[model samples]
Structures are given as C-alpha cells and as structure tokens.
Target: MHGPAESGWLLAALCAGTGAYCLLRMRSGVEEQRRTAGGEALMGFGMAAMAVPAAVFAPPAWAWGGYAALFGAVALRALWAARTGAHHLHHLVGALAMVYMAVVMAGTPAGGHAHGTGIPLLTDGLLLYFAGYVLLAGARLVPVPAVAGASGAKGWGDRPELARACRLSMGIAMVAMLLTM
Candidate 1:
C-alpha cells in the first residue's frame, strides 16, 4: 500500500498537469471551451489543495469547513447551470463529491484512521462509482477507428473529449484520496 505522503504528491502532479492542459484548451477561442477550462482549472486546484502532503500543508479544522462551503456553493451553481447542458450536471456531481470528502475528512481524527479494504457502504460505494466512471471515461478518450470522410481531426482543447479526459483524471485523483482517508 502506498503511504499518504507519496500518494499526495502523485495526485498533485496529476491534477496540476490536467489543469494545465485545460488552460491550454481554453486558448482555442471557443466560448464553451473557455468555460469548461475554468471549471477544470478549479477542480485541479481544489484537488491539489486536498491532496498535498500534510507535512507540507495540513489544513486546519476551519480550512476543511471552508472547503466544504466552497464546494457546496459550486455544487449549487452547477446545479443551476445544468438546465442548459449535461456537462453542468457532471460538474454538479464533482462539486458534491468534493463537499462530501470535505465533510468526511473534517470528521476524521488528526492522525487519521486505518481504513480496511472491506466495503463500508457509503465510502466503498463512492469508490466503486468513481472507479467505474474513470474506466469508462478513459475508454472513451482512446483513439478509435474513424469512418471514411469523417472528421477525426481534433484540435487542442476540444470540448466533450478533452473535458471527459479532465473529468476522468479528477475522478481517479479523488479515488486515490478517498482510499487514503
């Protein structure tokens, strides 16, 4: 099993890289891409804040509350925006997940508790959900055979596909975090 410290660094690197990629896509001059980039960047930074080594930056009790509040607000915004697009619904789910993690982590003791591999209902269910999502999203991101005369050409930071990859990356990172908790 990997230690929290090691996993923390790994998650940080993964999220940061993913965020940078989203920002790169934002440069495409597409309005939708720019909006998605903003959300992706926020998720990346939020994950980094949650996943960084405790030795380097352990958030105080109040900080966890702050995180919960922030994410809760984001969740509401996403929910409101969901009326227009399915992507917003995904954002709503992501925000709620963050809020859930923040609340659970806040309740945990300072040194943390030992988590068994056995199913614990809620946590384990969430783990399974995220795991399945990551796998499916990753599969979609893979290059597939295109039909003749079809537009298989995708520029940097394309919507839907790139957004899916970013969401998948965040979901994997979130699973890594929940495992350590």
Candidate 2:
C-alpha cells in the first residue's frame, strides 16, 4: 500500500513525465513553436508535489502557501493566454481550479488536518478538466504527411504521432494524480 508521501511523489512524477513528453512533442511541431502548455503542465506537477507533501507532513501555512503560489502563477498565465486568444478549454479549467485553490489556501490556517476538505474536490476537478483537454487536443490533430527536417535530419517537423502520445500520457498522468489526491 502507498503512503500519502508516496502518493504525492507519484502525482508529481506523472505531471512531470507527461509535461516533459509534451514539451518534446511541441518542439517537433511545425516551426518548432514553444509550447507554453507544456510549461503549464510542468507547473501543475510542481504544485501537486508541494500541496501533497504539505498536506501529509507539513503545516497548513506551508501547504497553503505552496498551493497559492502554484495557482497564482497559473491564473496569471491563463489570463494572458485568454487575452491573446490562445486559450483552450483545458487551460481555462486548469486556470479556474488554480485560482480557486489559491483563494482557498490563502484563507485557511496552516498546520491543520481538519481544513483540507477542498483538496480532494480541487484535485478531481483539475484531473477531469485536463484529461478532457488532452482528448480534445488529440482529436484536433491534422496530420502532416511527413516530418519536416533539414539535410535528412532524424527528427523532423510536425510529428502528429508524438503529439498524440504526449496527450495520452498527459491524460493518464492527470488521472493518476487525481486518484492520489
């Protein structure tokens, strides 16, 4: 059986692993556009790490602070993305949860077990939202015939296969995180 600490670590690993995979896929996309989504995904993993450990072993202040910072950053990024018309439904949900977590954490006291009622709900919601978004991303893929590259480079541009893999892994990771939370 896994302890709470182990669960937390697992959640963090899932987030980090999926985010890294997505980053790699994004790197191979057309024009090699930087995937801020991957960065956000990694940030989520970081937040999960901090929140879970704090909930299990640390004081409320530490837990709440970690949650607050994570959500605060996400909220800001979401707002910027929304304003730029680059927002996706998944990002919007993630942003909302982050903002909510930040506010809740800000209001609660530190070092208390009785005050973590909202954590589970937040985790579940985030999981579903992110998972849904990952599916949507996969469904939206318009395959490119060949991977673009220079001088017969092994790695080429726009690998839809990679993107699909990234999405699947990310979805599974999010599901795992939610269960652990």
Candidate 3:
C-alpha cells in the first residue's frame, strides 16, 4: 500500500481551511451559525489531527486512548441531543467512528496496519460507507428547487449543508487514510 504522506497533507489543508471558514462564521454574531460552526470546527480539527503524519507527531498509546475516550464522550453527548435534529445522530455516528479508529490504532503496533490481514469485509465495508457518504453529502450540497416556506429557505446555520460538506471532507480524508492502511 502507498503511504499517506501526500494525501494526508492535502486533507490537513482542506480541513484547516474549512475550520477557518467556520470560525469566521462563528464570529458573525448569529446564534445558529455559532452553534453549527462550533461543531464544524471540532470536526475539522479532529480530522486534521487524524490526517497528520505519524512521523511528525505520533501520539503515545495513552494519547490514543484519551482520544477514544474523548470522542466516546462526544458521541454520548450527541446521542443525548438527538431530539434536536437528525444532525445529532450523524454527529454521534461520526464521533463513534473516530473512537473506533483511535482504539484500533492504539491496539496496533506502531507503523503497522490495523487491518494488515487483508480482511475483505472490514476493508470493503469502510470503503463503501465512506464512498457513499461522500457522494450523498456532496449531492446534498447542490442547490435545488425548494418549495415555498420549506426548511431550505433558511440560512447556512439553519441548513446542514456546510456541516455536510465538512462531513464529506472527513469522509474523503478517512477513505484516504484507510487506503494507506
């Protein structure tokens, strides 16, 4: 498998740029934008962390464990907030995925493949999931005809489009990372 050296850096730049844009939105003094921007910022930073080269700053086992725990907590919080919207459910899933990746990496030897055995099921499943997520999310970002008084009439914060873009980016980043595995 090819190393992630190149793709990782590109993903990092994308995530950082998205995070900066979200931060700018957060400063716009809109409550809904602020809330959405907060989640986007977290996702962007988290993905950036995952995209970094291990040689540059490999975290210790404890750090990985901490990451798993932290994301687990975030997942739990998202679950608790599910009544707010479907986005919360997506957040929970994303956070849980992060936890899974962190725990798996923590258990694996340094510079070793977490799925080195070439397990078709796990590898193919991840590939399909991320690929579908990226496609669906990207499609949703496309502007379409909206019914009058529909939810689509709202601003960026009211809609999940920006958040979807962030998720799509993360999905692409994860797919790249998985390919390198």
Candidate 4:
C-alpha cells in the first residue's frame, strides 16, 4: 500500500485543484440560488483538502484546524440556507460528511491508525460519503427545453458544463479516495 504521507499530499492537491475549479464555476453561476450550489461545492472542496491530506499523508498540527474551520463554515451556511430557503437533503448530508471527516481526522494519530480495521472503516465511511455526494450533485442536472426562438441550444439545467465539472471532479475525488483507502 502507498504510505499515508503520500496519500495525504495527493488528496491535498486534488482538493485544491478541484476546489479552485468549483470556485470558478461559482463565478459563472452568479445568481443567488445558483450561488448556494457553488458554496456547497466549495465546502466539499475545502473539506476534501483538509480531510484527504490527513487521511493519506502525515497528519499535521494545522490539518484538523483547517478541517474544523471548513466544517463549521459549511454547516452554518447550510443551516442558514435551510432555514430561509430551499434546503436539499443531499447538501445537508454532504455537509455532515465534512463534519464527520473533521472529527475522524481530529481523533486519528499523526502516523495514522492501525490498518485492516479502525482506519479502513473510517476510510470506507469517507469514501461512501464522497461517492454519494458525487451522485447527488450529478443528479441535479435535469433536462430542460430550449426557448423556441432562442439562439442558443436548449438543455436540462442552467449550466450543463458546470454540472459536468462538479460530477467529474467529485467522481475523481471519490476514486482517489477509494484508492487511497
């Protein structure tokens, strides 16, 4: 098995790159309703960065701190969104996964826990959560008709490209997570 330290670095890199991409997409979806989705993506990206590094590489002092901050921020935003607007169960669960990851990372030792049992179970949980999130995000894309006289093509969802990006990035992250696990 590849060492945890190596995995941590890989996860961190994946999170950073994916998160940046999500941020870019968020910029394109500037509407308030759409912006929330972008924020959800950002939460995943940030949590992935914090959690994956701790899971794969040498756990560092600041790792949990970052994770905690990401978790708290997302959790609060999710709650606020839920209270005042359309709340998605998938988003809530995804946010919960981030919180769970933070807790797991905080409890794990620096070099990581014993393999085959404790660590594997936790990793499995993370993998499952990420995989589910990918599915949820992908499912958000639904077919929509084009305007009869509109110049551009009609399709499902406001931005198929952005939805595709979210799915691709999350899918890759899920794969990376499973492999690392």
Candidate 5:
C-alpha cells in the first residue's frame, strides 16, 4: 500500500479475497477452525480497508480515530480468544498493530513522504514480527503426515492447506503494510 497505486489495489484485493475465504471457512465442522476463521476474517477485512489507496479516497483524521477504536475492541476480543488457544495471540498482536498503524496515519501530514511517520524502532519491530510470521506460516503450507490436507468430502473451506495459505497471504500483506508505514 505504500508503493504504487497498482500495488495498493493488489494488496487490497488479496486481503479482501482472503477475508471472504475465511468467512466461508467459518462453516467448518471443527469448532476451533470456525472460531479461528471468524477472527481471521475480521482481520483480513480490516487490513483490506486500510490498504486501500489513499490517492483514491483518503479518510479524514477523525476516521483514523474510528479505526483505532474499532481495532482496540478487536484487540480485546482477540485477547479473550487467546485464552482458548495460543494462535489467537497472533490475532491480538495483529489487531493492536492495526490500531498502531491507524494512529500513525492520523498523524501523518496530507502530503507524506515515502517512509511513513512513526517511531523507526517500533515500525521495525512490527516489520520483523510480520516477516517472521510469514516465514513460519509459509513453512506450514507444506503438507506433512501430521499436517494433512483435506480429503474425501471435506469442503474447500475446511482444507488445512488453504487455511494456512490464507494466513500466509495475510502475513505477507501485513509485512507490506508495515513496510509502507
């Protein structure tokens, strides 16, 4: 999103598509998958909205406040969910990161530089987090005996590989978003 218009559009599409897939994945037979997919879908959609090209329609500073508030609640929800599983902790971090990014964007001037306005160390930490997550999630995409792919009558929504790929895509998108910030 920090790059060209083309890149912003691509990122938006990727995030939105992943979000939609995750939404459908909520119907999975596994209750845990359903819960995880629900949170992930929210995150994916939120990222897509944020990743929209500013050149097209820049939100007012106040709108960024709304974003912060929204993600704040999301972060809280993710925190509660983390009690059930360690994976939800990642969602909590992601929601908090969104809130941080929104606050940063609110402070940026109308005509901003390529390198966004924020504490370099903080931004770098976020970049590192997302990058490492991408690597780990990408590795999980490779199917193994323990991490078997969906078989028989399982729907696309229930496929572990596709779910992992969705998370991987979101991770890559997060890295890109953080880079621009």
Candidate 6:
C-alpha cells in the first residue's frame, strides 16, 4: 500500500490481528465455522502482507506475480466451495479482489504508484462492493428482535457476532486498501 509508513504499519497490524483471531476461531466445534475461519484467516494474513508500507519494504517485481498466483488459486477454491454456502461466495469475491489488487501492484513501478490505474472501473466496482458489504455487515451487528441469538451458553464457533465482526473488519480493511490504490 502506498501511504505513510505509520498508517501502513497500523493497517498491517490490524489485519494481522484479525488473522490471528480467525486462526483461533478455526478451533470452532462447528464444521462450517471452522471452514469459514480458515478462509478468513487467509484473507486476513494476505491483506496484512499487502498492506506493508512500500517505504519500509517494497517487494520485488516478481513478488507481485506470486501474490497474484496465490490469490488466484484461493479464488478458485472459494468458487468451488461456494456451492456449499453463500458465505463461500463472499470468500470468492474477497479472493478475486485480492488478485485484482495484486495484478495492479505488479503493474506499478517500484518506489511510487505514479503508474497506478487512474480510478478504473474495476476499482470503482470493488469499492462499491466492499463498501456495501461493510454497511450490510455493520448493520447485522446490531441485534434486532428478528435476528437475535438464542439465549444460552454459546461456544466460540457458535458466536455469530464475533464472526460478523471478523468479516466487518476485513471489509473495512479492504475498503482502506482500495482507497490507497
């Protein structure tokens, strides 16, 4: 991400922390929750790496290709997994977004983002998607009568709010990273 070293570091930390939490969530009793957490963990960690300040450590040109390839594979996996549930569709979108950003970065010259795309349609569309996701996810966080959870001792994997918060954080991180692009 092309930005102040301080802000980039902060973003990286935020993402890394989210990744760590997602890893913990993978110990969930529910198979679906564990599966979802694993995907979120990947996204969180990948975002953290990409958010690293260029001023601190700019990756070599080839590294961008590596990022693209890794995310591309992830996108494919998410696509296949999407058949099982709608959450996987969200994962598919997130993975594709990462791939898009990786390709964009690969095209950017080292030391500066001067060659960055000038607000292309892809970027705009992604911004709309993540922004809308953030809004919808944020709204879901507020407990309402219809969507309220049942009262009882909830296991870590069964905690919908935490999972939603995880997604919300990723959505915010995505929006921030997109803005920098």
Question: What lDDT tens digits, residue by residue, belong to model 6 across residues 1-181?
Answer: 7788898899899899999989989988988889889989999999999999998899999998998899999999999998888988889999999988888888787867623463578888989999999999999999866546757677766778888998999999999899877
Instruction: List RMSD in Å for every model shown.
Output: 3.2, 5.4, 3.9, 5.0, 2.2, 2.1
Q: Which stretches of candidate 3 lie over 4 Å from their true place?
A: 28-30, 117-126, 145-164
Q: Estimate each model's TM-score.
A: 0.83, 0.56, 0.77, 0.62, 0.91, 0.92
Tell me how candidate 5 scores on lDDT.
Answer: 0.86
Write candidate 3's Cα lDDT for 1-181 as tens digits: 1245666678778878777767766754577568767776776777677767675667677977887888888888888878888867867767776776776678777666565533456666777777888888888889877668775455544445665676677777767756654
Cα lDDT of model 1 by residue, 66-179, tens digit: 999999998998998899999788788778878877877777656464254323676777788789878988888998776689676667866567778778888898788768
Candidate 1: deviation at residue 90, Å?
Answer: 1.9
* TM-score of model 4 (CA atoms): 0.62
All models: lDDT? 0.77, 0.55, 0.70, 0.58, 0.86, 0.88
Q: What range of 10 consecutive residues in model 6 has the weakest lDDT sum?
A: 111-120
Over all chains combined, what TM-score does candidate 1 have? 0.83
TM-score rank, highest first?
Answer: 6, 5, 1, 3, 4, 2
Residue pairs in candidate 5 whose N, alpha carbon or C atoms collide under 3 angstroms: none
Q: Find the candidate with the highest lDDT and give its number.
A: 6
Q: What TM-score quantifies how close candidate 2 is to the native fold?
A: 0.56
Native-structure RMSD, model 6:
2.1
| Candidate 3: clashing pairs of residues | none
Q: Which ten residues in a row have the lowest lDDT in candidate 4?
A: 111-120
Instruction: Name model 5 segments beyond 4 Å from true.
Output: 145-151
Better of 3 and 4 by lDDT: 3
In model 2, which residue pairs have backbone atoms overlapping below 3 Å? 59-111, 60-110, 60-111, 61-110, 148-157
Top model by TM-score, which number?
6
Clashes of 2: 5
- By the lDDT metric, which is better: model 4 or model 5? 5
Task: Tell me the deviation in Å of residue 24 in model 4.
Answer: 1.8
